[model samples]
Target: MKIAFVGKGGSGKTTLSSLFIRHLAAHEAPVVAVDADINQHLGAALGLDEAEAAALPAMGAQLPLIKEYLRGSNPRITSADTMIKTTPPGEGSQLLRIREDNPVYEACARTVRLDGGDIRLMATGPFTENDLGVACYHSKVGAVELCLNHLVDGPDEYVVVDMTAGSDSFASGMFTRFDMTFLVAEPTRKGVSVYRQYKEYARDFGVTLKVVGNKVLGQDDVDFLREEVGDDLLVTVGQSPWVRAMEKGRPARFDELEAENHLSLQTLRNAAEESYGNRDWERYTRQMVHFHLKNAESWGNAKTGADLAAQVDPAFVLGERSAVPQPS
Candidate 1:
């Protein structure tokens, strides 16, 4: 199952992401967490010190190598240099499984030990001085999008992503990649505004978006979120001294979580468990091909000086384990 945590700035999406990751890891679920946020704070929330977090290789810095590895021996993909971020997986392209022994994970992710067990994490990377005038954050996030596009996971496996705040993810098809997206909304109007934007944007795509109300102080706060979002409000995390202490670098445990907070995490876990059986490979494959063609037409062909549409093998299906002959 794949999960995305998103929200308005300071809505504690990163904190909630870490909590969910911790809960999954502690329960012995195989999972990987990706810090796709430009703010880049998921590591600190996961208990990594500044130096250790900085040491983990940035996925953006390694785009070329990742593209090279993921292209594999696909006949349609003649060269890695021709591979754009939206390149969809075909018959011969390499596909990723969660925590599989692979060079991509070795180079881009690091293991962080926690009270339960260690969890693997990867980051899209920080906006550097070089990118100040020259780049868009989308370029950095493309690594994650491509990874998700090519990844094939079993129901027991999990991928948790901490998305960039607000609707910034709408700039690309990244928001549509998750199996379920938890929008961490506070009781404030500013919080629900993001939810409204996301719900409206994703309504047409059939993305499963549920709300996790954070910082709820009382029934009034909970009522405010319910009144605003209705049944979409899956669960709420109330004020938590334990979370504050942990985020402050003091030790904390999942068992020590406030009753409501712990129940909220369980609700999320239950949702994930239920969704594994509902995997939609056809929709996933459609999305990959859709974005690939869109990018190819938009700028990929001009940038690569070749008809990038050749990268898609019409006879090849993403989830089916079979091969098709290369077209003449």
Candidate 2:
């Protein structure tokens, strides 16, 4: 399953994302953690020391190769610049598998060894001085989305992304790329407001969103979220003293987190595990086409639209209702 964690800047979504990745690793599951946020803190949150995290390359920095691989040998793709987020995989496009043998994996992924299991980390680099006025953070995020769109993960595997905070995710269709999105919200008006905005926009895309309340101090805080989000509220995580200690430079593993924090992590794991099922391939492909056509009309060429349309898997668009299987 592919899961994304998004919310307000201080909502603790990054911390939660790291914790979930650690949880999957502890269970010996195959997982790749993508730090799609501009701040790029998921590495440190995953227990990588400053130096180790700094040494890792960002996927955004490898955009040239990424685009080249994705374009493959497709004759219709004349230049990498024409490759948009909704660009479908074509004849020569490289298929990404979580295993290290995949060229895409070799090009961008870094394995971080942890006590439980080693997890691969892929980052989207922060916007640099050169990008000033020349590019937007959305461009960096778009690289991550493009990589994900080309990836095929096993049922027991996961791709956990830490998305940019707040409504910025709506800047691109990246918000619709996940099987599930965990919106980590603080028990405050502003936090709940972001949730409302996300739900309203994502409703039409068939994206499943669940709320994870963070930094809840008391029943009052919990009640506020319950009232605002209702049953969409899945887990409420109180401020973790263990996390605070770690922030202070104390060493701590995920399993050693405070009891409350550990339980909250388990709740998230259960939800993810239970979420495993069949994907609606027809619906997914239709949505991709919708976004691709919309993008083509706005910024892409007519041929780009035609090429993308032709790339949609026949079984998916032909109304066969067959399962569009991925690598297991």
Top-scoring candidate (TM-score): 1
Q: Measured by TM-score, how close is model 1 to the native structure?
A: 0.96
Predicted candidate 1 versus true structure: per-residue lDDT over 122-192, tens digit per residue: 99999999999899999999999989888877677889999999999898887878888999999999999
Clashing pairs in 2: none
Q: Which residue ranges in model 1 land beyond 4 Å of their true spot?
A: 320-328
TM-score list, all predictions: 0.96, 0.90
Tens-digit lDDT track for model 2 on 55-150? 778787788888877766656566676787777654455556665455556777889876599999988877788999998898788788777666
The true-versus-predicted C-alpha distance at residue 119 of model 1, in Å, is 1.5
How well does candidate 1 score on lDDT at residue 234? Answer: 94
The local distance difference test score of each candidate is 0.87, 0.78
